[model samples]
Target chain A: EPEVTQTPSHQVTQMGQEVILRCVPISNHLYFYWYRQILGQKVEFLVSFYNNEISEKSEIFDDQFSVERPDGSNFTLKIRSTKLEDSAMYFCASRGDPSTNIREKLFFGSGTQLSVL
Target chain B: LAKTTQPISMDSYEGQEVNITCSHNNIATNDYITWYQQFPSQGPRFIIQGYKTKVTNEVASLFIPADRKSSTLSLPRVSLSDTAVYYCLVGGLIKAAGNKLTFGGGTRVLVKP
Candidate 1:
């Protein structure tokens, strides 16, 4: 199975600073997603993207959060200004186009540990 | 999206068969039950998925009753390496991109040798 790869296994940034997490999803997959798991908390969905636009987003995704598929191969999550509450493990996941699969499941990257001081 | 309820944790000894059951009382007709396993500090990995009846994979087996309101994930002859958090998710009808997937608090399985 093709894997989704995330760069910078760990990142630490000062509060109010900007950060970008990069991910390379499976080559043939068409949908992308971002999820975060705060320490000891359930993993929370942040957003989903497809067709160069956001398809759906959770309330946790605020104005400061943005996603981009720059140059087609890379999907990125950018936080304009990080906050202490932003500290968590951010995961990138993708699945192939649904038309080809009925029991669709996502393939996830290892994840990026983001720490905002 | 259907809401899932599962135990917070379970303990088992190596070589024992383990089953974690999840209940989604309001599950939709087209919803599918999927299970994922996540080791410490690693991303979730797919285990198995089933719409109804039983679906078995090399890693695990997903059993859904005829009503489709509940499902159980069975891991045969568990080992210490089988310790991980198991997540149950029920997805919408689209079964594809744009469908919302909400993960519930997972069942933490502790396999001791």
Candidate 2:
């Protein structure tokens, strides 16, 4: 089965540094999303992307965060000036058509573990 | 979004059947109940989803009563490898722009030998 793939399975960065996480969603998927889970916490939604623009974002997705569909197959999340609290597992997910008859399931990648020092 | 309540953890022996139930007292007409499983250090994986009644798939089965206030995820003949956290989510199926999913603390299941 086709799946979402994220690069840099693990990344360690210093505070105030910039980091970019890359993901390649399923080829036929039309919706993409970014979610993060802090250690021992529930998964939180960051942002959702469709048609090349952000559809919705959470308070956690503040000015420091941004997402882009740089190409037909690549979706990226960039965090400027990372902080210690930014350390968490970032996941990329995608879903197929939104028709009600079809099963709308979010397929997630293995996730990238980001460590900020 | 409806709030879900589930047990914090459960333990079962290998080859035993496991059932995880989630309570959502405020489920809406458009809402659907979906289940996801996550292993340590990995992302959540979709298991099954249903609006009402019982829906069965190869991996698992979902049972929703007439009231739809609660749902159950049944895993048959579980093994040690089935040890993981299972999440139950309630949301609408409409394709609205900027739609996002909210995940609550999942139930951690440990299957022993």
Candidate 3:
């Protein structure tokens, strides 16, 4: 089965530094998303991307956060300034066509562990 | 988005069946119940999804009653490797770009030998 792949499985950065997390969603998948989970907290949605534009974003996705689909295959999330609270596991997910009968399940990557000091 | 409630944790012995129930009293007409499993430090993996009635797949079975307010995820013959956090989410289809998923507090299942 094809899977989503994320680069730099672990990242360590100092406060105020910029960080970009990269993901390659399934080739045929259309909808892409970024979610984060603070240690011991529920997974929170960050943003969704489709048709090369952001479809939806949460309050957690503030000014410092941005997403890009620079290429047909790559989806990236960039944080301009990192804070200690930014430490969490960032996940990239994708889904196929969204037909009700198909129930397009979201496939997730193994996730990148972001550690901000 | 409908809020979901589930047990915080559960324990079972190897070879036993495990059923995790999730309650969503305010589920909408277009909402679907989806389940995801997550191991330590990993992203949530899709298990099964159902709108109503029972849906069965190779990995698990999802049972949704007529009311569609609650759903159950049944894992048959679980093993120690089955130990993971299972999340139940209620959301509509991603027809447009703006529809995002909301994950609830998952149920942590520990299968012992």
Candidate 4:
């Protein structure tokens, strides 16, 4: 089974520095998403990307966050400036188009553990 | 999407079946019930999803009554490796860009010996 792959499984960055989390979604998948989970907290949606544009985003996806599909398979989430609160497990997920009857199962990557100090 | 309410935790034995129920009284007509499992520090893995009636997959079964206001995830003959956090989510009909899965506080299942 094809799986989503995220780079830099663990990242440690200084506060106020910029960080970019990289993900390669399934090759044939069309829709992409980013979610985060603080330690001991529920997973929270960050943003969704389709057709090279953001389709939806949550309140937490503020000015500091941006997602880009720089290539066919790469979906990247960039945080302009990092904060302590931004430390969490960031996950990337993708699903085939609904018309495919794939049931839209979000294939999530193992996730990147982000830590800001 | 309807907010889901579920037990915070459950305890089960190694050879027993475990049923974790979730309530989504305000589930919309277009919404579906989906469950995911997560281990410590890893992303959630899709378990099962159902619209109505009973749907069973290789790993678990989802039972949704006619009312669709609630659903139960049944894990039969669980083992110690089955210990993890189980999340129940109610979301709009999943599409290319419309499926935003909101995970609530998951039910932590502790499978004991």
lDDT of 1 by residue, B1-113 (tens): 88999999999999999999999999988788889998888888888888889998898888899988899999999999999999999986663347756888999999998
Model 4 segments more than 4 A misplaced: A102-104
**For every model shown, what is its TM-score relative to the native structure?**
0.97, 0.97, 0.96, 0.97
lDDT tens digits, residue span B59-104, model 4: 9999999999999999999999999999998877665455778889
What's the lDDT for residue B8 in model 4? 99
Of the two candidates 3 and 4, the one with more favorable lDDT, higher being better, is 3
DockQ of each: 0.69, 0.70, 0.73, 0.69
With a 3 Å backbone cut-off (N, CA, C), the pairs that clash in candidate 3 are: none
Residue-by-residue lDDT tens digits, candidate 1, A1-117: 789999889999999999999999999988899999998888899999988999999999999999999887999999988999999999999988787545548899999999999
Worst 10 residues of 4 chain B by lDDT: B91-100
What's the ranking of the predictions by lDDT, best on top?
Answer: 2, 3, 4, 1
lDDT of 3 by residue, B1-113 (tens): 89999999999999999999999999999898999999999989889999999999999999999999999999999999999999999987667664677888899999999
lDDT of 3: 0.92
lDDT for each residue of candidate 2 in B26-96, tens digit (9 for 90 to 100): 99998989999999889999999999999999999999999999999999999999999999999886565
Q: What local distance difference test score does each model get?
A: 0.90, 0.93, 0.92, 0.91
What docking grade applies to model 4? medium
Instruction: Name the TM-score of candidate 1.
Output: 0.97
